[model samples]
Target: MTGKLYGVSVGPGDPELITLKGLKAIQSADVVAFPAGKNGKPGMAESIAQTYLQPHQEKLPLELPYVQDPDALTTAWAVATDQLYEHLSRDRRVVFISEGDVSFYSTFTYLMLTLRARDTAIEIQTIPGVCSPLAAAAELGLPLTIWAEKLAVLPLLHNLAELETALDWAETVVLMKVNRYYPQVWQILRSRQLLQNSSVVVRATSNQQKIYADLTNLADLSLSYFSVLIVRRSQQWFNSS
Candidate 1:
């Protein structure tokens, strides 16, 4: 019999944020695979799930390049898929851990695609966890969406014009991977006089978590790679009490 694959979301930053089912999968899996960050650094997913990892489980860190090129991404996913396939071929249960939810802007998505493409009959399961945007909102006591309000969760914005267009009509916008383009985003929000409505959370729910309730005047500030920016068109909904 072939082994099953589990995409376990370890949640954003906080180790305790992992779901019960996710922990069980991690503890019971024969092999645990996580993305190996730049320069062979341990991936965040593995770090978050380290406490639950059993001594008998094999750990596999698959190299994943941090780039936007489709070819590079495909190659990286192929490599990871093959590594996971090695364990599966031996009838060993494999669980690929991921940060945040596996379906949202996660590297596991690409790996899952490649694995399924290789064999459509492969058994795959996803265990959902709390995503960053919601974590940031909860930390700030802000409502992401309410009533008929619209919300947009965008990946790192490269073009200010495109970002302006995307958030112009939406009631709320959650900008993931904001550290790279934060200066530009600050200028855009300032130009639109929406700076006061913007808030930032760095490494939300983690020990290093930092919150910026108002970034109206913060200039040229450097942030960590795990930062997220949330912008509200109107501040009428935030319950700061």
Candidate 2:
């Protein structure tokens, strides 16, 4: 008989941010799984969940690469799918975690799709956790979206093209995955005179959390892919608060 597959979200780096429901899922799961880079030995996601994990059980690590190679991703997913499928056959409940909410641009989404196609009866459950966008709002003490202003969460897909488009109308724009393309994001915001008004947060809600409004010197900095940019139109608004 196939067992349950729980998708848990260990919010940011703060263990306390993990939901009580998520803890229960982890505690009862028979096998805990998380993705890693091809060379990442100990899964970063699993390591983050270690604080809430029981002492005796070791985490099951799945290695998936970040680069864009269709064949490689397919192969890696297949191998991982097989490993997870085997656990289900043994009736071992599995909880796979992502850094933030499991569904939001998480690797768990990829695995979920692959697993679903193969087994129609496998039960899948997801629990939401805190994300960096909200965390950035708290860290910088900024109102993300007030008076029912439109808010857009756009990934730094390729360049600042989408960001430029969003700035034209969005009252609050959260640009996620801004690490590799920091300079690109900064240039567009500065050109629009939105630099000082925005707040850049890396690793929000974690011990490594770094917040800065000084975008002038951010051209050379390297940030995690988990970084986020909270952009508001008015500079005086954040200043007054």
Candidate 3:
């Protein structure tokens, strides 16, 4: 009997936010895997699910470099899949933990895609958890959508073009991974006179969480990589003088 693979979402920052199904998967997994960043440090997903891991369970730290190079990313995914092959061949239950919903801008999707390509018969299950945008919106008391309003969730903003389009097309826009390009993002919003309706949330729902409702201070603020910017195109809930 070949073992199965489980993709578990641990939720955004807060461990208690993890779904019961996700927790059960973590508890029963014989081998636990998480993507270690370029710094080779433990992943946020692992830290969130640490309490659920059994003392004797095996751990796999798959190195995922923080690089935009496609070749490098593909190679890393291949290598990580190769590591999983060894355990799966031996019929060992494996669970991979992801910080947010596995289906949303997560490393687990890459692993699952490669694994399925290698063997189409491979069994995989995914457990969803609270995504960052939802958590951030809750932290700021901002409604993601009202009635028929449209909501767009963009994982990254490489340029201002897409940012402008998002603001124009949707009533609410959630931009994840906005830390690096925040200055530019702020400028674009300020140019369009949309700053008053925008807010930035860092490490939402965590002990280190910070919310910035004033876009004016955004220029001087040093944000974390975990930060997200939510723009209400028409709402003036966060108006700043």
Candidate 4:
């Protein structure tokens, strides 16, 4: 009698943004689960969902070491799955929380894969939440993609060549983690004449939201890793020749 597992997305940072359905799922679960960062600190997802967690409910946290290396991530995921395996085998329901839509660049994906590989008997369900990127665009009142135009959502550390290619072919480009290579991204956008048409959103959907249309301050500004830069209808390719 294996238990059911839920991977719920809590939306971005604002607690009010959590969908009613996700909240109901978490509330009804027997145990709540979340992944902490490399330092073993509590996770943001758990913090956001804390208000809704019952006083008697159990919170299961999986410590995941933050590293880009895939091998290291795999190790952490396997270890974390162990923490939930036993309870799940007993038919105890478990809910794993993640920020934004669980499917989009969330750490929960790794654990989902691990459980599947280990043949965990628990049934898994994922509930969608508004992605920060989408909410960011909404804040700016800018359309991410219009009729028949493709959009690319890319993270920093993506190769410059691939970045350029996406910028070239796509009608709109959403660059996440732009803070990692702010200067480089700025230079690329400026050279391609797309800088003026883009908007940089920091702390999207939160009270401290910042939107910048000017690239003049972009080079000096320090953006959060959660930030996103949206380029819409940017057909300007200076050297399209």
lDDT of the structure predicted as candidate 4 = 0.81
Clashing residue pairs in candidate 1 are: none
How do these models rank on TM-score, best leading?
A: 1, 3, 2, 4
Clash total of candidate 4: 0
**lDDT by residue for model 4 over 1-241, one digit each (tens)?**
6688899999877888899989999999999988764455556787678789997788887887757898888888888988878778878989999988899988888888888787755589999998977888788876677568898888665687777888888988888878888888888888887777778888777667788965745667788777888887553343352
What local distance difference test score does each model get?
Answer: 0.88, 0.80, 0.87, 0.81
For 1-241, candidate 2 gives per-residue lDDT tens digits of 7688888998877788889999999988878888863453455566578877786654788877786789998888889989888998788898998887888878788888999999888889999988778778887877788776888888655756788788887888888877777777888887988777777888888788888866766667788776888888855564566
TM-score against native, each model:
0.95, 0.91, 0.94, 0.90
Candidate number with the higher TM-score (1 or 4): 1
Clashes of 1: 0
How would the candidate models be sorted by lDDT, starting from the highest? 1, 3, 4, 2
lDDT of 1: 0.88
Q: What TM-score does candidate 2 get on C-alpha atoms?
A: 0.91
Model 1 poorest 10 in a row by lDDT: 232-241
lDDT of 1 by residue, 106-139 (tens): 8888888898899898899999999999999999
- Cα lDDT of candidate 3 equals 0.87
